[model samples]
Target: MRKARGCFIFFMIIIVIAAVIIFYFIGSNDRKIASDDSVKINYSEELASYKDNGIDYLFLGIDERENENKFEGRTDTMIIMHIGNNGKNALISIPRDTRVELEGHGINKINAAYVYGGVNMVVDEIYELTDIKIDKVMLANFSAFIKLVDALGGVTITVAEPLHDDKSGSDFDPGTHNFTGEQALAFSRCRATAKGDFDRMDRQKYLLAELFRQKANFSIIPQIPDILKILNEDTKSNFKTFDYIKVAFKMMINRDDFILLTLPGESATIDNVSYVIVDPDEAKIFLNENLG
Candidate 1:
């Protein structure tokens, strides 16, 4: 009996070691694509202070559930992340269904930029629409997204309604809910409620903030190897290694400094299609007032 117990203990130790090795390899791989077209880039040209202490990056969640390789999908979620010099951060979520003026496509749903021209095009359209310069971009499709949330040991969220979706195999009750990767995806995709995309945006921001909050635990640091592997495989970012470390430290140090804001716009329809139209004059004022 003593010999058998020793063998079992050794087997468990081996299994644990193997899991660690696997995650390390998974987290270490990363490939970056360089862009040659300068005209398409807009965020880099700014003042020294803005370039140094203050930086802005756009996080784009694309619904490439259909065909990610082909780059065919709508921009399911668009968020602008801004970090101030004092380590203060602000995240503004843009609703997908908001109607706006497309750069070359005239007027259409803002999310349609992905279907028309992929990430670069979508980024350009946003620059034209908002006049806010974006310094970096992070893009993720659905699968990578699920992996990211799950890697974080799932995020805690408030599920307002009993959500049931057959396709994604998601069903959750209303309350403070703990969500796995699949559940988070469903929560982000939900548009059936009374507020529709508006409500969904709030949930996305809330869940993301919660995840950031949870990441403050020192325990997550060791998991970096595994997380980086998943991120390399499933996520795309223009962030350098220092940028990642800086952001992580900032989140840890000043999690409460995160401010939330939505775009200043109203719903309007032109012809037959509905749009979230930003009154240009009013928008400039709002941007200067809030950001400046």
Candidate 2:
């Protein structure tokens, strides 16, 4: 009995030491990511007021190209990830061409808010449009998206039909396949289908859902450092490293509960400019019903 007790205590000590070492590395990585100069964030009073729900996040995909100013580009994609308290989570896509009135910039595409006032402006516009309060925001450029996808060992997506678009450099035949970073970007950017931008938004939601599902698994633990490095270099967000870690755990545990939604709207040509017209009341109702 004495020898068995001694062995048990020795194993417990080893387990405790291993846990401490793991936590130390996680904390170090978090601090390194937070210390990056480019990841600085300034919170506005309005944004602060909307912090009722701690799990809501707004993710923006910027269209900036290589050598261009990343901070000034129009948002190519906008998504709200709402993690409900009841174990229900949702990925809601807002079309970039959705029509909205900017405070000082008159009526324009919703994507323009990013150019006028960055992520804060986009948050305000979304609130104005859907009455949904965003708790945090993440902005990633094309490079970030590509690198992050590749880092995750790519995502699997199914193309319903053959899609060919020269503008976005996307050409995929109908089938299911694992896509590289470049192919994923092209798939998300291609809007040459019958529904145009709406189809693109659907693809974005699907791709993101798949990415989250893959990333939440235990197999990706060895790649966390590379993933964090990519995020630190190419992404800007109000999320701390711990916040990301918690989100990943939540996603892994509740992967089956995740659902995808797109803001309801119709395409219209107004004054020769194309736009997606969404009714505010209807949008709120739709979200309220589905988000829970």
Best by the TM-score measure: 2
**Tens digits of per-residue lDDT for model 2, 46-100:** 6565544326888888888633787558888899888887666899999899999
What lDDT score goes with residue 49 in model 1?
24
**Backbone clashes, candidate 1:** 5
lDDT of 1 by residue, 196-233 (tens): 66777877787777888877667675465557777666
Q: Each candidate: RMSD to true structure?
A: 5.6, 4.9
Off by over 4 Å in 1: 1-31, 35-53, 68-72, 164-170
Q: Which ten residues in a row have the lowest lDDT in candidate 2?
A: 36-45
Deviation in angstroms for 21 in model 1? 9.8
* Cand. 2 TM to true fold: 0.85
For each candidate in turn, the TM-score is 0.78, 0.85
